[model samples]
Structures are given as C-alpha cells and as structure tokens.
Target: AREAGAPAAELAEITEATAVALRIRRTLGQHRVREAQLTALFDTASDLAALRDLDAVLRAIVHRAKLLLGTDVTYLSLNDDAAGDTYMRVTDGSVAEAFQRVRLGMGEGLGGLVAQTARPYATGDYAADTRFHHTTTIDSAVLDEGLRAILGVPLRLGSRIIGVLYAADRAPREFTAGEVALLSSLADHAAIAIDGARLLEETRAALVDLNAASETIRTHSEAMRRAEEAHDQLTDLVLRGGGADDVAAALADILDGGILIHDADGAELARARTGPQPPPTPAVAASR
Candidate 1:
C-alpha cells in the first residue's frame, strides 16, 4: 500500500489491522497447541485407568513426553531401593546404548538432583553446567548421546520421589518454565500409573500364593480324612473278632499294596497280596 502511494492515514490503519490479524493468528495457534496437549493428557489418564502392563504404560508415557516436548530424547528413570540409585527404565528417540542403560546415583547428576530434591531442573548446556554434581559415568553417557540441553522432573507419589522424567536436546537450548511445569504434570500422572501397576503386580502374586496355600491345606485335609477312616475300619475289624487274615486283607485294600504278618517266632501267620509276594526279610527275624 505504501509503494502504491496510498494516504498515510490509510496505510497506518492497514498496518495496524495486519498487526491485529497476526496477533489473533498467533493466539489461535497457541490455543490449538494447548488443546492437543490436553487431549494427549486425557488419553494418558485413560490408559492409566485401564493399565495392565507396566512396560507398556511406561513406554507410552515416555513416547508422549517426547512428542509433547518436541525434543531429541525423552526418558524416565525409576528408583531401585535395593541398588540405592535410579536407573533408566524407558526411553523415546534414543539410540545410544550407554544412555539407555545409564544409572544415576542419588545427587549425582541432573536426574539425580531432581530425584533427590523432588523438584524440576533444567540446563541449557549440560556439559558446562556446574550446578549439578556430575559423575564421569553420567558425563560420558551424556556426551555419547550428544545431549546438551536437559530437563528433569521428579516422579512424585505424595512426598516420595520414585524416579525422574526427562527431556533433552542434542543442541544447547533453554527450557522454559512452562515446559518444566508441563513435564512435571506428566510426571505426576506417570508416577501414579507406575505405583498402581506395581501394586497390582503385588496383589496378583499374593493371590497366587494364597491359592497355592489353600490347595496344600485342602490336600492335607483329604489325607487326614482318609487316614482316620482307615483307622476306624481297622478298629472295627478287631472289635468284631476278625482274624489276622481279615486284618491283613483290610490293610491291603486300604493301602493298595501287599500285606504280610508273622508271629514272634518268625513264622508267617497271614498274607494279602495285590501282586506277587516276596520272602520275609532278615529285619523281621531280628524283630522276632
């Protein structure tokens, strides 16, 4: 319009109108992005609600984190009480083997600081950052992965910090506070899902143990009943003046095996056989 020699006042109005339109477009774009983020979060919550497998749930969480943050890598670390450290549990857009398998001691690195303090931390240049306690192992892995900017947030369940969720870039870039808060929110959801999955696993194992114990008890009870019934039958046979042969026959029927009796002089008195019978042993003679 200015090149075409439009009036100054008219040109000013046009420029102002163009500026207003640009602002509106920017605002709409931000709203759309926010809407998409909200949709993803809702989907994540639904996934957690119907969660069955912990690995699947964790993979989904890290994948969503990488997508939402638009970073080079996204990953999660889980605390190992027995190992006394946090180890990487899941990763998205990661190719380095060492980084995927990295373990961070408490207060050892950016992730360790986040896990230890239960707070969010970010560094635009991790290699140059002196705010965190860096270890050779962590530094070597980070260098190998070529991650320069890093952000980490605690995975908190109540006051306990179970792990850390992280986003990183291969180039130096500042992480905004909004990004920190967003990752933290995702971590909150991830924490709850992780805890729930663990509890469900424990419950399943306990149920299996309970069922095994119940089965054992039932088998023992059945054996006891059979033994008592056999004892009663033998007692009744003796009370009725049944002979030694009758007792031996009853023993064979109850035990489903051969039965033999001998007197104190080592002379055979009665025998009942389900199969061929063998001669009396020297132990029987010794007893006589």
Candidate 2:
C-alpha cells in the first residue's frame, strides 16, 4: 500500500482511525454481552422470587445457570456446614452418577476453593490447573463427567458462603472475565433463592402448627361456651323456683345422657333419661 503511493501521513491517519474503530466495535460487543447478562440476571430473580418450593427453586437455578452460561453442564452444591462439606444438590446436563453426587470438603477442589474463598474461580483445563487444591474424589467425578474447562462461583448469603455454582465444558475453553462475572451474578441469585426457599418452608411449617393449635383452642372454647350457657340456664330455673325435676330434665337435655338429682343424705330426688340410654339404677341415683 505504501509502494502504491498512498500518502504516508494519510495512511498513518487511516491506520489510527481503523484502530479506533476496532476498539469501538469491541466496546460495543462487550456492552451487548453485559446487557444480555443483566437481562438474564433480572429474569432469574423474577423466576426465583415466584417459587416457594425448595426443590423446584433449586432445579430452576441449575437450569438457568446452564442456559445463561451456555455450558455443557451446570450444577449446584449446597453447603452443609454442620457436615463440613458441600454436597451436590441439583444438576443439569449431567449423565454421570458419580459426577452428579460429588461432594467436596470446605477447601478441596475448584468448587471448594470458591466455597472457601467465597469468590469465583475458573480454569481452561481443570486437570492441569495448579491454583486449586485437587482431590481424588472430585477429580474422579470430573474425569467421569468428561469436563475440561470449569468455572465455579460462590453462592453467598450476606457474609456467609452457602454453596458453589458451576458451569463446565467438555473441551478446554478459557472462560472470559465477563463470563465469570455473569456466573457470579447468577450465583448470587441462586443463593438468595435457596435461602428464601428454606425460610418459606419453615414459615409454612410454622403456619401448619399454628393452625392446628388454633383449632384445638377453638374446640376447647366451643366446649366452654356450651358449659357456660348450660350453667346460666340452670341458674335461671332455680331463680324462678323450678323444682329438682326441672334441674334433672335440663341437665339430661344438655348432657345428652341420663341425669339424676339427689338430696342430702344420699336420697334420690329425681332422674331423667334421654336418647336410648338405659335408665339409671336406684343405687346409682342414690349415690349421686
């Protein structure tokens, strides 16, 4: 081009203009990617907010992670802090049982490193990565699943690291910084979903117990109301100079059972029977 006699200063200006154009194009592309990722994060938040069932929420998280990351496999592990390990809780695009059930100690493997540090970690070829502590069990599962490239991000709740979310590919491919950021954003959503689901479950259980206790209290209150009404009725009868037979009849009607009245010295005064109940014996009436 220089030999073709295009002006040298013009060529320099054109080259610089071309470089500026390339940079602009690259920035535009990056902006589009970030916009798409932000949209995905919003969608994930909306989807998770509507779900109350824990299992359903977890399934949705893994599915969304797989979709947004466009990885061959995606999975989530929940931290069992009491057990001192993070265990696989949900998976998508996984065919290996061993891989699906893999568990990692708090500081083992790439996922464990995320859990331990509460940050995002990625590798183009996990088997050769020296930045993470590898374990036989995790390695075996990765091998079984045929995963080469892996990205793991911490699922966090406030200051607590709750678990790890992963996106893995079968072939070695370096994950971009944008991809890591995208996955980290998704991981934040997943953590909120899990924590919120558990809280909802607890709330539902509490509501059930509260409802049951309320029913018991209502039943007892109803019984007490009937007793109060019966007492007031019997007192009115006495105030009106009604006889013992009046008392016996009122008691029989209200109790739905045979009634007996006795005077002092164990002498039977009156008896009433209702509903097919056998008449009270004289001995029973005298003893009342």
Candidate 3:
C-alpha cells in the first residue's frame, strides 16, 4: 500500500508542475503578443513618415490605432486656429452625431481635457463617469452602443498642444500599462511628423518673401543705373555748349537742378543752362 501511495504522490506532483509550466507559457505568449503589437505600431509610423499628405497621414493614424488596440472606434481632434475650436478630424462611423456637432473648449471634454493637460486619459467605465460629458449625441448612440472603455493621448509640438488621439472599446475592459505607453509613444511620433511638415511649410513661405524682396532691390538698382546714364548725357551736353562765364551762369540755372563743371586744375569752370542751351561752339573749348 505504501509503494502504491508513493507513485500516486509522484503523479500528483508532476501534474502540479505541468500546470505551473502552462501558466508561465501563457504569460510569455501574452507578453510576446503585446510586444508584436508595439512593433507593428512603430513600423506603421515609420512608413507614414514618407507620406506628405497631412490629411491622409492623420486618417492612417486613427485607423492604425483602432487596429492595434482592437477597439471599435477611434477619433482624432485637432486645434482649429481659425475657428478657435477643437475640431474632429477622424471619427469612425461609431462616433456620435453630438460629438460631430459640438466643439469642445481646450479642457472641456475627454479629448479636450487630455489636450489641455498633455497627458493620457484612461477609463474603463465612461458611461458611469459623470466627469464624462456625453451630451445628446453620444448619450444616445455611443453609450447605448456599449462604449465602455476610453483612452486619449495628447498630440503635441514641443511643449504646445496640437490635438488628441482617442480610442474606445464597446465592452468594458482594462488597458495594460504597456498598451498605454505604446499609444503615448505613437502619439509622440505623430507630433514629430506634424511639426516637421509645419516647419517645412513655413520655410517655403519665408523663401517666397525673400525672393520678393530680392526682386524689388534688383528693380530699384536698374532704375538707378538708368538715371545715372541720363545725368551723364545731360552734363556732357551742357559742358560742350558753353564757355566758363556762360557755363557758370548755365550751371547756376541748372544748379536749382543744375550742373557745375571744373577744369582739370580744379578751378571752377562752367555752370550750364538745364534747358536747351545755345548749340555747342567749336571755340567754347568744351567749358573747361
């Protein structure tokens, strides 16, 4: 009986060991899945950088979030400077009509609050939270549709807020800390791309202004060259027409918009009429 009991005890111990090994394997598998998801997120983001169309990029961002997080809905809100309002850029059809209609202040709603604070907002029970402002659109459609979990990460350029990225699940669920970190990292990559595009636009505008200024300067310089040529012609004509005394009087007349001529010795020679002077004489010795 003792020998039989020993073998049974060994069998029980082996079963317990096998169960523990299975649990560890399961945990490792989950961790690997999470790591694979994060790797996919970064891969998608790296691919997106090659695209220049801002609208398409933003849409891709939302779509990818919904895919990686296994959420039914994803939304992106951007700050509209012209309207001084936060406007939705992407909302899966699951987004409520009310959310589409109303604009939220910088810190008013979930997305807005996330933008205002520059942090992530996570909730497993959005329906039960009074802090959530469902309004009529979401209250009837989304809440009723079973949107139980929410996550929002702010998009930023340096220290400034640009918008928010949001995801929602229909069933009550918990987001792992690793998931939140992955999302926030994705948001950071997006902000960097957005900032780069904006800076590129600004640089193009500045180049345009600089080219305009350079063109203006070139035009004024051409005008000055033309004026100088015309002045030299007028001066030569006056000097050729008059003697010292005659040229001096003419120079005085033209001096109020006139010309003076001096000999090579620096002696005052002639001032000529600005208007048509008598035709040049061979004996005038060209005013000098």
Candidate 4:
C-alpha cells in the first residue's frame, strides 16, 4: 500500500493509527497478566487458609509460588533468632539434598540479605552477583542445583522479619515487576499461615496445661474434704467418752502408720500398729 503512490499526510495518519493499535494490544496483554496474578494470589490465600499444620502451610506456600512463577524451584526459610540465622524450612521441585538443609547466616546469601534487610532482592545470574555475601556451603548448594536466577522476599510480620520466601530458576531469567508483586503477595499469605499455626499450637498447649492444673486442684479438694470429715469424726468420738485406746486405733487406721498415746507420767496409755512395729522407748513416749 505504501508503494502505490500514497499521499504523505494519509501515510502518516495510517502509521499513527497502527502505532495506537499496537499500544492498545500491549495494554490489554498487561491487564491480562495482572488479572492472572490476582487470581493466583487469591487461590494461594484460599489454599493457605485451609491448612492448620505449620509444615503443611509452608509447603503449600512454596508449591503455589512455584506454580505462579513457573520456576524450577521454590522454598521458604525461617529465621532462627537464637542463632541469628535463617534455615531452610520447605521446598518445592528441589532436588538438592544439601540445599534443602542449608542454613544461611545473617547477611550471608540472597535469603540472608532479605532476612537482614526485610526487603526484596532479585538476581538474573546468582553466580556473578557480588551484591550478596557468598559462603562455600550456599555456593555449593546453588551450583549443585544448577540455579542461576533467584528472587527472595522477606516474610515480615509487623516489621519483624521471621523468614524469607524464594523463587529460583535453573537458567538466567530476569524477573519482572509483576512477578515480584505476585511473589510478595504469596509471602504475605505465608506469613499469616505460619503465625496462625504457631499461635494455635501454643493455645492448644496452654489448654492442656490448664486441664492438668484443674485436675490437680480437683484431687486436692477431694482430699481436703475427706481430711476435714475425719477430723470432725475423731473429735466427736473423743467427746462421746472414747478412751485414748479408741483414739489410737482410729488414728492408726486412718494414717496407715503406728500410733501411741502416753500419760503425764510417760507411761504408754494406748498403742496401735498394723505393719512394722516401732520399738518402744520410755524417752520417746515422754517426748510424745
């Protein structure tokens, strides 16, 4: 059409119109991508919400991350405050055994950087990235897994960094802004799931403790009631003219131990014993 002697003004208008059409198509494609991201986030939220176990929730989060990002591997690491480091918690599509159990010190690797700073970090080529501190163990794991790209986001709970969520690819790939946002969304849900499961476990343990205390209190109360009844009965027997012998026998039966009553002159007035007999002594009776 351009070679058919078209007017300059007409050709310019056509070119502009084509450019506008391309722009509209690009905008529509972007919108579709955003829509898919939202849908995936919603589904992930649903999936995490239904999980009650801490391990199960973390596993689901990584699995969803792998699906949404289409990555070769996904995993989560939790911060160990006592150790001041982060350790691998769960993984999806990961074949490296050492990587699954690797621990990263604060500011050590990509996940460590995220945990220390509580921010997102991405690298198209992890082997060449000098922005993070590389350790022999982490480097070995990454190399073994053949991972070149990495993106990590902190699992933050009220400004406190508890852990990090990561999506990694086997080959070099630049993660886009949309992909980052989606990852952050998934991390938010994961944090909630983790915190919720922990709280529930604590509550259950508290209830168990409370129940044990209640049982103890009940047993003590029953024992106290029986002791009070025994005290009343013993007092009534004495008031009804029962002698020291009766008191000694009754006390021995109740205490399941030896009983002896003495007079003012240190003479044994009454004695009762069902089991091993305690040797009689005039000095002991005087003291009693």
Candidate 5:
C-alpha cells in the first residue's frame, strides 16, 4: 500500500498479478457466452432433424447457419458426380453464374478439395488464395460474390463425404474455435437428415415398382381363371350327350347369342349369342 511504503518491485508484482486475474476473468466470461450460444444452436439443429423433405431440410440448414454464425452469406454444395466430376448445387448467399453448373475434378478446386479430403478449410481472402480460383466468379458475372473470410466444412455421413456446407463474410472476421466445432456438429446432423430423405425417396420408388408388378400378376391370374372356367364348361357340354353335330349346333347357337368376351388387355376379343336373339354379325373368335 502507499501508506505502508511498499517496494517498487512489490508494487509491480501486485499490478502484474491483477492484470493476469483480469485476463482470466475475461476469458472465462467469453467461454461461458460461447457455451450458451452453442447449446442453443445444438438444440435448434436437433429439432431440425425432424424435417423429412430434402429442400425444406436444406433451407433450414442454411437459415440456421446464418443465425448461428451471424453471417450474411451461407451456402451448401452437394457433390453430384455420377462421372467423378464435382458440381455445386446450392448456396445460401449470392453466387456468380459462372460457378453454376460448373464441374470441378476431385481436388482440382477448393470445393473439390473439401470433397476429396473430407476436411474443413478456412481462408481470410479467397481471391488472394492460390489454392482457390477467383476467376470463376468473374466469369459467372456474379458481382456480389465477395468473400473476405470463408469457412467450408465437409458434410460427412459416417466416413464418406456427401457434400459441403459453407459460410462467408464480405468483411474480414475471426471465427472462434467453438464456432467451428458447432458448425461441424450441425453438418453431421444435416448429413444424416439428407441421407434419410434420399433413402425414403428410393423406398417410395421401389414400392411403386412393386405395386405395378403385383397388378400385372393379378391380371394374369384373372385371365387364367377365366380360361379354366371356359374349359370346364366345354367339357360339361361334351359329357351331356352332345356329339360333334350337337356340339356344332350348340356352338352355333352360343355364337349367335349376343355376348361379349373381355381379355386382360381391355379388348373385346370375342362375342357370342347369350340372349334369345343371335347377333346379326357373324361371331369371331380371338386368342390371347
């Protein structure tokens, strides 16, 4: 204390200790704030997993990323390479047209790198980075595609990278370690929901094919049943003391009867006289 005439060295030591304490307090406060924010984000993303529609889920993902990261630009890219070429699907923020439908070879570009490596990447200035190509934006005529700082996280389902989720800021900004971790967690949930939606769509298509097959089988069974009935009726006629002449007479009468025979193809294949009057037109027989 001043009144106690403390040594200058001792005073300096006390000042240094106070400064360290203050720094620790500030750091601890920041940690608590980040923790709270991450908890809320995690809960929100967990709720979002209930969404089953792919487009709706993607929109929610971008919206949540914007909210959680406090960035104006958010984007998601899914790799659609049936032929081993990477293409961009969608983005939350404005992108240049040149980038649209542009395919990149695996590991040839930044997005490609994310897909190939299945890792997260960040850059302070995309234009300055030799690893990224800014000319693509220029070619696309997307003037609003300015990125001072960007974060790209690979979206993985199990060990495979399905796509990538990204956020960008026009003004340079530093993302906390916690924010990166939170984004990673969100990407995991997003991948699961996306994959589930894809599987559901596949299952629905399979069910449709199965239904068509079942209908075809039912139609064939009905045709067989009709043929069996006809055979039994024909046998009964022969057993009832009908000789060839009698059979011919009976067939001629039945043929003269005005009746229609239908086949599985919805065609009126044959006609007979089931009524008292015979058909004025001659009877015609058809085979399946």
Candidate 6:
C-alpha cells in the first residue's frame, strides 16, 4: 500500500484494523483458557460431591493442580496436631523418595509458613528465598527433588488451616497472581472434601458404638427379667408349704438344669436332673 502511494489516512486505518484484530484474537484465547479452567473446577466439584474415599479425592486434587498450572509437580501436606507438624500426604508428578516423605515443622518452609499463617506464599527460587525459616531437613528434601520455584496455599476450613497445597517447578520461575488465586480456589474445595470425609467416618463409628451399647443394654434387661420371674416362682413355692422335693423340682424346671438340696448336716435331702448328674464330692456336700 505504501509503494502504491496509498493515502496516509488509509494506511493508518489499515494499521488500526490489524491492531484490533490482534486484540480480538488475544481476548478469544483468554476466554478459551478461562472456559477450560471453569470446566476443570466444575469437574472437581462433581468429584468431591460423589466422594467415597478420602485418599482418592486428595490424589485427584493434586493431579488437577499439576495440570491446571502446567507445573512439574504438585502435592498436598496435612497437619498432624498430635505431631505438631505437617507431613506430605499426596503428590503428583513426583519421583524423589525423600521429597515424598518429607515432614515440615510449623514455620519451617514455604509450606509451613502457609500453614502457620493460613496464607499463600510463592518463591521463584526457594533456595535463595530468605522470607521463610529454612530447615536442613526441608531444604535437603527440596534440593533432592530439584524444586526451585514453589507456590503454596493453605487448605483452610473456616479459621483453621488443616494443610497446604503446593505447585513446584524444577527451574526458577515467578508465579503470577492469577495462578495463586487458582490454586487457592482448589485448596478451598480440597479442604471441605477432606473435612467432610473425616466427619462421615467419625459419624459411622459412633453409630456402630451406639448399636453395640444398645445390644448390651438389651441383653442385661433380659437377664434381669428372668431373675425376677425365677425369684417370684421360688417365693410362691415356699409360701404354699411346698416340700423340699417340690422346691427342688420347681427350680429344676425353671432353670432347665439339675437341682440338689442338702441339710446343714451335709446329708442330701432331694435331687433332680435334666440330664446326667455327677456325684457331689465330700467338700461340696459339706459346703452347706
């Protein structure tokens, strides 16, 4: 157009049109990315709603995080209140054994800081980052795993921080604000699923205990009822001037077993048997 001596106004209009076209293309690309993210999140919520196993839900969360951010690795750590620390619970795209088993004390590393403060933290170079309290154990594991850049967000349930969700890379790279928010959103879903599953298990155990207690109470009630009936029958027998043999017979019938009566002088007065009877020893005979 320039060589053909096109007017300056026409050239400017063409340049403006090209710029508009580029902007529209960029906007469409962004919309596509947002749509994909929304779809992934919707699927995550669906998975959580149909949750059956806690471990499977956790694994899915980590895997989704890794895919969403296109990172080298993603993992989750859960706080152990009794142990006073956070330990790795699940991982995706991770291979190092030391890294998989690493445990971090409160405020010890990026994950620890996120757990302790209940906030998100990211570092482009974890080794050189001085914003966190570094420990030999945590640093060594990170080094072994070859993770340089790391981002961590708290898994929060109300005001409590139950764990940390992390995305890490082997090479130094700065994480963007959008990425932080995305990971934080995922952490929120993960936290609710974890807490819900735990509560469900606790409820199931309580119901089992309640059933056992009810059964025990029912058995005890039956025993007491039988004892009361037996006592009333025996009392009526004695009141009616029933002889020792009659009393023994009544006891044998009520108890569905044998009965023996002896006087204080160790002499057998009467005996009844439902089946066989062994002769009483001299010690048993003198028991009266």
lDDT of 4 at 125: 97
**What's the best-to-worst order under TM-score?**
1, 6, 4, 2, 5, 3
lDDT for position 70 in model 3: 77
lDDT of 3 at 221: 96
Candidate 2 vs candidate 6, TM-score winner: 6
lDDT of 1 at 179: 86
* Candidate 6 collision pairs: none
Give the clash count for model 5: 7
**lDDT (Cα, tens digit) per residue for candidate 5, span 1-288:** 656999999989999999999999999998898887778677767767687778888888887888888886877778775867466666676665554455656675566678889988777666566876545533233234666777878889888888888777887776767778777888888888888888887898899999999999999999899777766766888888655545544555544544554455435544444433343343343233
What does candidate 2 score in Cα RMSD to the true structure? 4.5
Q: List the residue pairs that clash in candidate 4.
A: none
lDDT of 1 by residue, 1-288 (tens): 888999999999999999999999999998898888888888877877687778888998898899889999999999988888999999998889999999999999999988888889999999999999989999999999999999999999999999999999999999987788788889999999999888888999999999999999999999999999999999999999999999999999999988988787877789899554566688866777
Which whole-number lDDT from 0 to 100 does residue 155 have in model 3? 89
lDDT value for model 2? 0.90
Clashing pairs in 2: none
Per-candidate TM-scores read 0.90, 0.76, 0.65, 0.79, 0.73, 0.85
Candidate 2 displacement at residue 223 in angstroms:
3.8
Q: Could you give candidate 6's per-residue lDDT for residues 71-151 as a string of tens digits?
A: 999999999999989999999988899999999999999998888899899999999999999999999999999999999
lDDT of 3 at 258: 63
How many angstroms is residue 218 displaced in model 3 relative to the true structure, after the best TM-score fit?
2.9
Q: Please list the Cα RMSD from the true structure of every candidate, rounded to 1 decimal place.
A: 2.3, 4.5, 10.9, 5.0, 6.5, 2.8
Evaluated at residue 150, the lDDT of candidate 6 is 100
- Model 5 worst lDDT window (10 residues): 279-288
What is the lDDT of every predicted structure here? 0.91, 0.90, 0.74, 0.91, 0.72, 0.92
TM-score of 1: 0.90
Q: Which ten residues in a row have the lowest lDDT in candidate 4?
A: 274-283
The digit string of per-residue lDDT tens for model 4 on 69-126 reads 9999999999999999999999999998999999999999899999999999999999
The TM-score, computed over Cα atoms with residue i paired to residue i, of candidate 6 is 0.85
Candidate 4 RMSD computed on C-alpha atoms after optimal superposition onto the true structure: 5.0
Q: How accurate is candidate 5 locally (lDDT)?
A: 0.72
Which residue pairs collide, candidate 3?
Answer: 247-271, 248-271, 250-271, 250-272, 250-273, 251-271, 251-272, 254-257, 254-258, 255-258
